[model samples]
Target chain A: MSTQTDTRSSAVVAGSFEGDPRRYLRGLGGLLVFLLVWWVGAMTTQPSYLVPGPLDSVRAFIDLFATTTAIVVPVSGSDLVLPTGLAHLTETLFHYVPGLLLGASCGVSLGLAMGWNGALDDWLRPLVRVLRPIPPLAWVVFAIVWFGIHHTGAAFIVFVGAFWINFYGAYGGVEGVSTDLTDAASTLGVERDLSMLKLVALPSAAPQVLTGFRTSIGRCWMIVVGAELFGAPGVGYEIINASNNLAMATSVAYMFLISLAFLCMDVGFRLLEGRVLAWR
Target chain B: MALSSESSVDRESREKITVRNVSRAYDSTQALEGVSLSVGEGEFCCIVGPSGCGKTTLLRAIAGLDDPDGGSILVGGDPVTGPGLDRGMVFQEYALFPWRTVRGNVRFGLDRPACDCADCEARVRELIDLVGLDGFEDAYPKELSGGMKQRVGIARALAPDPEILLMDEPFGSVDARTRDRLHAELLDIWAQTGQTVVFVTHDIDEAVTLADRVVVMDAEPGSVQSTFSIGIERPRERTSREFVDYVARIRDELGSPIDTIE
Candidate 1:
């Protein structure tokens, strides 16, 4: 009897596994159709400069890694040549990583404090209400004045974008926690206020908190590209430079690189999130 | 077991719980009005009432999760001020932390200052087995059925081995068949633990089957209306005439004579 039940359950599992690959195939087929339409449109456009085909973009992307670009050395004030793709990509990450980490951490901590404590909510609500309305791009002037036209200035803008997303996510998550969970924790001997927050409130709000982190990551990526328009290093700067030089294919290639980077990071984060919240 | 053994001598001599004129009000609505009850060590008491009877409020008060507006509650002769480790509570919703596995949830109460790491794991394992959730130790609460989740909740509550257990409509959410099995399992655990249990439910039949004594409560003002002593033997037969009589008496006390006929 037990063996029969086991076989039935395993068959059900096998059925689901079969369904997954078919779903992936459908998704891949859709992407191919999209690419075909894009190729036809590019072929009809006058001058390859106006609308570069997928082949042109792909070639430009490969050439970017193989070729070098000359840049003025900051310390010695001498000309130096470096690999364009690697140098620009590293520069973007230097600012993006720091800004995202700093902003998300600060926002989540403050939001949790505000949501959990009535006094903190009252004190900070008005300030957040006033500041959150201002766009992250609006801080570019202040960024330039504070840190000059550098990676630090660009990073500051990315930080502003990431902050609000995480703040609201964590705040709403904490507020959504059911009172029954807290009461259960209390009876389970976690009577202290701090202990209750750590054990019950935080874990209960984790799904929301993780959602906030995921959103902030995507938002920060977009903001970093815009922020780099202010004379910072990275793919954004490369795209702007290529466009100015009328290298439309190169500009499009840089755009694709940014998207590819975002996709890789997003997949990595989703895997981590799956592992962290496996209990769900 | 070492913890229980050390406290066993003191446990036999002490009074389990004393609730004296405990009154709690929310705004103008009185949830509980001057309720008084005392339970002896190792006693199984069930509090039954109609909807909005404040049975849950009373159980929360006993667990020290809520403060009474008037009078006091004591466990083992000590005034109940706040939730303490000596009193464990099982909620109607099971309230198992969704993020924690069955064993992790059971280990939560034992991960206190009073318990060491190795001892806590042992106690968790023992409680998991006691609640018949041995193979499901690593399973998340979401993966379990309603009955299984409540079993985890019961194991979690029992892991600390409190002198008193306060449960608020614990098996009310499960199906009738599952609830019947749970009742038998609960009695077996209660017999082994020898802890004072105060269970709150709206089901008269459940009270009659499980309780040594039933405290019937009224709604609106929310006060204890009457008490009935059940002399039925263990592994109670629901179809038995004595059991039916006990259920009828409690239903009459609830002021619902029509329900008895039904």
Candidate 2:
């Protein structure tokens, strides 16, 4: 009896919405339903100030860009005017970018080293395990004390958040490197430990490393907002200040900004990942 | 047959590889014990055995990918301390670097100073052509079929222009038709490059088809059982009486079919 099916199966499962037009319509439908529910909830609330309508929040979001603020330029020592939303957003980015980049760099390096070297793993594993569970926000007290609630203080919190994610990603990736590959490399005249790691292990571990970095990118943004909540100048500060003033719609607007920023970064990174990991 | 008879006198004088009393053990079980064999220069030698026969282990020792627990393996009068560019290896699984393209994989073994130079690029192109993978130089290993991937493995191994080519069932995974085509292509490559080859396989017909000398092995503390010389000429007719006779003799020498089942 023949075992083959009459028709070939598609790679994507049945009913999958990837690259399909219906998925877009469905997404728009979902957003509309959510907005309707939100609007109904706002009408039922005891005080309208507690739960502003989606329209009010949208107006507040637009106002952020229309308003301008003056700030002293560090390099030029001159006053520069920028849109209110952008002024705070730039301050958040100043710490978020450097913190994620530096922490990810150090974490990946250390993780790769530990994964490759058994002795180093043994030496550092205990310390890492003890420090790993302490939340990034918990370090805020120390950050404020050490860096004086400036960008550096918020940056340190973001760094802590980024470091552990990337560390585990790189560590697990290197640990999972195939012995078959290493043996093949050995036969091909790559014998030294460092050379083996570079020529064989590193490339093999690349997908995992990139995956970890991607995860950290999203996680670090969450940390940035939390870090800014304690009187640091950013969207988080705006969120807290607006809520304290009972301008709840302004707080919701900044929250939406955070989500939009995260979505943009995630989409950009995904495109880059697609290019980098095309072989996979 | 006549050609092999004529060359027999000179074969003893050009011993390229000498494995002298090699022994290896894993934990409690002995994989190989006091096994000794020699291959002449430019010779095509195949080792055939059942599962657990340590054929791959012996091949790995020759490649210097593994160290024998006892005894020594000498290639071209020098002891094999570790893997070197002098010897190239082809694995059954086609262990290609997935991240690298066909061109990149083939260029892996080239000396660092020669990399990215015009000559190096030419050499990579030449190897890709040799393995019949000319148009697929830009393709990744994941994109290739089983036969194509093995071809890339062969091209990558030959990139360094080694003196000895050691293969462990390099065509075992491919289908019968592809395996036959690869066999002919491999023989053609072997003839063009006069490198000594030590191939290992479990297939009797395969060993009969490719090897100038087939060495049969037995498992459970694996050691050599017998050796047979195939005097048949190139492009051997598999259905011919002489070819069938050789296959029968070797199969008989391998012992009962029941012994090989497990």
Candidate 3:
């Protein structure tokens, strides 16, 4: 009887797990369909120079596998290979990961600080508003002159793209926290500096914090591609190289790889969020 | 008269909370003005008044959740500038942290504080049972009924083992039956702990049923208009003649049936 009850409850929970699979699965399926259409369209184009067919792209991709830097070096001294698609994604992540970490941490901290202290908000408001409108891409010129095509250059550009989003989201979240929660927390002996932001403000603003993370995650792809297009390192560079040679299929494939990486990141974060706020 | 030597939150053991010439105003509207009262140690003093009669305002001031506009409030001989944990408060809205289970909410005050009291968990369990929540400790506030949520709020207020409990119309949101049940439950908790409590309620029956003394205030710059001693025996019968007499006298003075008070 107990086993039967457990089975029934498990079945109920398993059924509810289908809650938003359509949102993710459909998104995944849609990307595949888009790639199929691109592949077919490239095949129909007779001029190989104008639109390299999927076969030509596959050949180039395979060549990269033969010559690619191996992630795990074997003691046997046999040459190891990585799939071109995966290598390109990893390259993109090199820029994406560090930029996101630095930018998000700084953004959330500064935003919270400003939101919590009215005096600080007053002091920084004018300066932040003036600087906020300048596009992150505008700094690419300086990025080139200073870093000169290094990973740091690409990361700098990526940080510029991601930071503002996190800052704004955290700012809105902190500011939107209810004053009543502050009073509630303080009534229980949690105080001013350690208080509203740490206990009440952060919890009340969780949904907004998630929004900021989502925004920063989305911005990473754009910055990655933009950095590559501007002569910075990564798979964005590969996409530019393929496009210049009119390897339309390879360019399309690289785009799909980056898209897949982003989709996986979104799914991972969503899962983490669901688990963390299980009480909600 | 009891626990006078227990160092209650008063300079004079007669008054647990002293709100002397207290007044508060929001722009032109006065929430309280020249309102003063003394609640004694271990006393279950209920404040009864009309809507917007500053009953909640007075309790908030007593809890140090709000500062009086003009006068002074002293708890244990210390002038309160802001809220302190020495006084625990329960609001009309239940005020239990919705994200926490019943036991979690009750023991929230203990989470951060350094303590060696081995019976802390046992006391929380006792409180949950005392408030009729032993089986519902794992349940969230959203899962509980209105009465149960209020019980959790009461449990939370008592969690810190504060000297006084300030309740603002805590049972007002529940139906009559549930409210009555909670009234009985609250009295049990009070009796068990001997905690000083100042409860705010507009229900005359409720005030007379639970309180040792009922303080009724008039509206518009609200201040005490009258006081009635229940003086009824323990576990007072709501339908008893004395209970009826106290309820009727206050109701008559208020000049309406319960519905007419609206």
lDDT of 2 by residue, B1-262 (tens): 0123325326536999999999999998788998999999889999999888889999999999889999999999999999888899999899999999889899888853245576888999888888777767788887777788888888888888888999999988888877888888888888777778999999888999998999998888889988999999988889989899998998888786723583
Off by over 4 Å in 3: A1-81, B1-13, B117-119, B135-143, B255-262
Candidate 1 CAPRI assessment class: acceptable
Task: Compute the TM-score of each model's chain A versus the native chain A and list the values.
Answer: 0.87, 0.91, 0.79
* Cα lDDT tens digits for candidate 1, A199-269: 88898888888889888888888889888876887889889999899899999999988888889888998
Ordered by lDDT, highest first, the candidates read 2, 1, 3
Models ranked on TM-score: 2, 1, 3
TM-score for all models, in order of appearance? 0.91, 0.93, 0.84
Q: Model 1, B1-262: lDDT tens per residue?
A: 2223433335434568888998999998899998988777877899988777788999988888788999999888889888887888999999999999989999988886557887787888888888777777898887777788888898888888887888999997888877888898888788777888999988888999999889998877889888887888878998999999999888877886523432
User: Which candidate leads the pack in DockQ?
Assistant: 1
lDDT per residue, candidate 2, A147-201, as tens digits? Answer: 9787889989999999999999899999999877887777777868988999988
Lowest summed lDDT across 10 adjacent residues in model 3 chain A is found at: A1-10
Q: State how far residue A54 of model 2 sits from its true place (Å).
A: 0.9
Q: Which stretches of model 1 miss by more than 4 angstroms? A: A1-26, A69-82, B1-15, B257-262
Alpha carbon lDDT of each predicted model: 0.83, 0.86, 0.76
Report the candidate with higher DockQ, 1 versus 2. Answer: 1
Q: Runs in model 2 with CA error above 4 Å? A: A1-19, A71-80, B1-12, B113-116, B256-262
Arrange candidates, best DockQ first. Answer: 1, 2, 3
